[model samples]
Target: MKFALAQINTTTEVADNLEKVRTYTRDAAEAGARFVVFPEATMSAFGSGLRTIAEEHMESWRSALSELAVETGITVVVGEFATTADKVINLLAVYSPSGERSDYAKIHLYDAFGFKESDTVEAGEEPVLFTVDGEDIGLALCYDIRFPKLFAELSRRGARLTVVAASWGAGPRKAEQWEILARARALDSNMFIAALGQADPEVTGVAVPKKGPTGVGHSLVSDPLGKVLNSLDGAERLEIVELDLSAADTAAETVPVLTNAKLGY
Candidate 1:
């Protein structure tokens, strides 16, 4: 299957961001992508403030996303800010070609970014594994990458490719952490990893420090062997790569690494 990961910059303008998503969805469809993924909070970049997020609800955002899914005839996974009865949460909306929807909330929040995401958002404890074109896939957010057990559970539940939708800041240390950790997760779990992040001049006006590098925009696709299949650097990108879940079976049959790594549950 052809998969496209969208790394676009989003701000407070929900209409503008939705338009951009539509354009990218059309582009991906024209390019023959069967599935398309968007970055976290693609609708509107609610800054590190709680009031900003609480004010934005999922009702308005879901309508546009559902419309886009029906129009494109492509499986679109979009991340946005959602509010429940209790608090706001980072959410991923997985829409099927027929307009069916499934959601996964951000399980782990990024509290280190001078933002109290957990305080404003209720954390999700369950992991989600959904199907696309007969392939089982996993869903995760940015900070969730730091947790291996979550990915392992999805893998055990038959997820061959885990899509990480994130708004990673630009910074050398953070970028390095993301890169190494992503590849490691792919290698250890023996599954393909599609990680997409946002670009510089973040929607938030905080002005990410030049020294920090918020996100160098090197969105990548890695195989089970920890090999980089394709990548993009600088600016927003829509990368389409062929995801062959059968390949994972073949690799595991030959190496059988996962077979030996017992979890002792």
Candidate 2:
């Protein structure tokens, strides 16, 4: 199956972000992709007023996702936020053409690199996965990629491919760390890892709020064997790559990391 990885700069405006999603979904659908993955902060970028949009625009966000799925006949996974009384939940919203919709809240909040995501975002308790045509797809967010246990748990629960949505912070070796972490997680879980990141704002000349982990665009996909199939530089782009989903099974059969594990989640 073919998958499209969407890399674009997220903004503080939700409407503009949704329009970007629609445009990318159309492009992916026309290119014969069954699944299209958008990076984190698809609803709005990480800046001030995040909670406001999460509170007011959540219903419309869901509506757009559902409508996109039904219209394009493809499963859509995009990042969004849902408001809580005290904070917001960083969410990965999933929509299938069959009218099935589900979400995975971000389990691991970004509390590192001098950023305190937990101050505004609540962490998810459960690891989530959904199926498309009998092929299981796992869900994860930015900091979640750092925890190998989550990936193993998703694979334990039957996932051949994992989607990691991120709006990575820009700093020393951060981009390299993102790439290494993606490849390492692919190896750890023995599954295909699609690491989608937001486009670098600097590339687009968009002034982002300071101290925000806006983006450092280098979205990529790693096969079960941890080989990079395709990757993007720091730019806004929509790249598609086909995957032999069955390769996950072969990698598992050859390495057997999940089966031969001495640990458990």
Candidate 3:
């Protein structure tokens, strides 16, 4: 399957970010990618008023993304905020070419690294997997990559590829940790892991809220056997990557971790 990893920066403005989404999705479609995956917080960056945005513009975001997907003939999976009564949900929305929209709320909250995401957002209760061309692909948000169980469960549910979208925080060794976690999760689940993150604001030259997981920007694509297929530095990028979905079977035969697992699932 051919997919594109869209590592673009965002701001607190919904209209502005929506324009970026259109441009990148068109470019990816032109590059012959059937689908495009973007980082978390794509609608409005993390530091914005998520509740207000979700309440006021969530439908518009969905409408625009669905139209973009149908127009480009490509699947669009991007992160946007979902509103509740009081707080917001870190939503990973899937907009397919058929005009159907699905979403996965972020299960893991970023309550580490001096940040308390739980204070603002609620955790999701389920995992979401979508199929394209008969191939299963799973969805996750920024902090969800740290948990191996999520990936394993997705693989057990017959997902060969997983996209982990992020707005990873910048700090000492944080980038290294992000890379390591992605590779480990691929190995843990014996499936492909596409860890796409927001481009560093320093690289995008976009000033954002100073108090959350803005970005660290080292997007990566790992094979089923935990090999780094492609990686990006701290910059904005939209690259098409060809994936062999069948490789998951090969890795499962070689590792067999999922088959031999006894607990913690």
Candidate 4:
């Protein structure tokens, strides 16, 4: 399957961000991508003051995702603030070509970064996976990347590809760490991995910046062998890569790590 990683800079306005997402999805479709993975909080700005910019209605966000899926005819893994009746959930909504909707809330929060994500968002309790084009695709958000247990669980459940949408912050070391960790997860789980991150301002939060600036963008797509097949530099852009789930499955079987995993978490 062909996948496109959308690197967009979201702002305070939800409508504007949705339009940007549409335009990018079209760009991905034009590039012949069958599925597109967007950054976390694809419809809203991220950061310390995010509480003010957060959406209160999951229905509105769901409607936007549904329309985008229908119009583009491309399966999309989008990031959004999931607001429920009881609490808010930072989640990734998976929209299929047939207009079906499903989601996975973020399990890990970045509370150490002078932020209190757990305060506003409820953490998801289970590892979630969805099927697309006959492939079992696991879903996760930013911070969740650090938890190997999540990947192990998804791998055990027969997920062939793990798609992540994130707003990874700046810092060269952190950027490098993101790459290493992503590859590690894929290699250990023996599954194909696609890690998508938003541009800088979209990640820095509302108290930081809105838009009109470059982000420390380093979006990447890796094979089960932990080889980076496609990479986008620091810029707001779209990257498309074609992959074969069968090849990844072959590599996983050859390694057999999933079968021998210790199930630590």
- Each model's number of backbone clashes? 8, 0, 0, 3
Tens digit per residue, CA lDDT, model 4, 43-124: 6766544544564445676787798889889888888885555556788888987989888988898675565667767788
Screening candidate 1 with a backbone cut-off below 3 angstroms (N, C-alpha, C), the clashing residue pairs are 169-214, 169-215, 170-213, 170-214, 170-215, 171-212, 171-213, 171-214
Q: What's the C-alpha lDDT at position 226 in model 4?
A: 92
- TM-score, model 3 to reference: 0.98
Q: Indicate the TM-score of model 4.
A: 0.89
Ranking by lDDT: 3, 2, 4, 1
User: Would you list the clashing residue pairs of candidate 2?
Assistant: none
Winner on lDDT (2 vs 3): 3
lDDT of 3 by residue, 113-219 (tens): 77799998988999999988888899988889999999999999999999999999999999999999999999999999999999998888888788788899999
lDDT of 4 at 167: 82
In terms of lDDT, which candidate is stronger, 1 or 3? 3
lDDT, candidate 3, at 145: 93
After superposing all C-alphas onto the true structure, candidate 2 shows an RMSD in angstroms of: 1.2
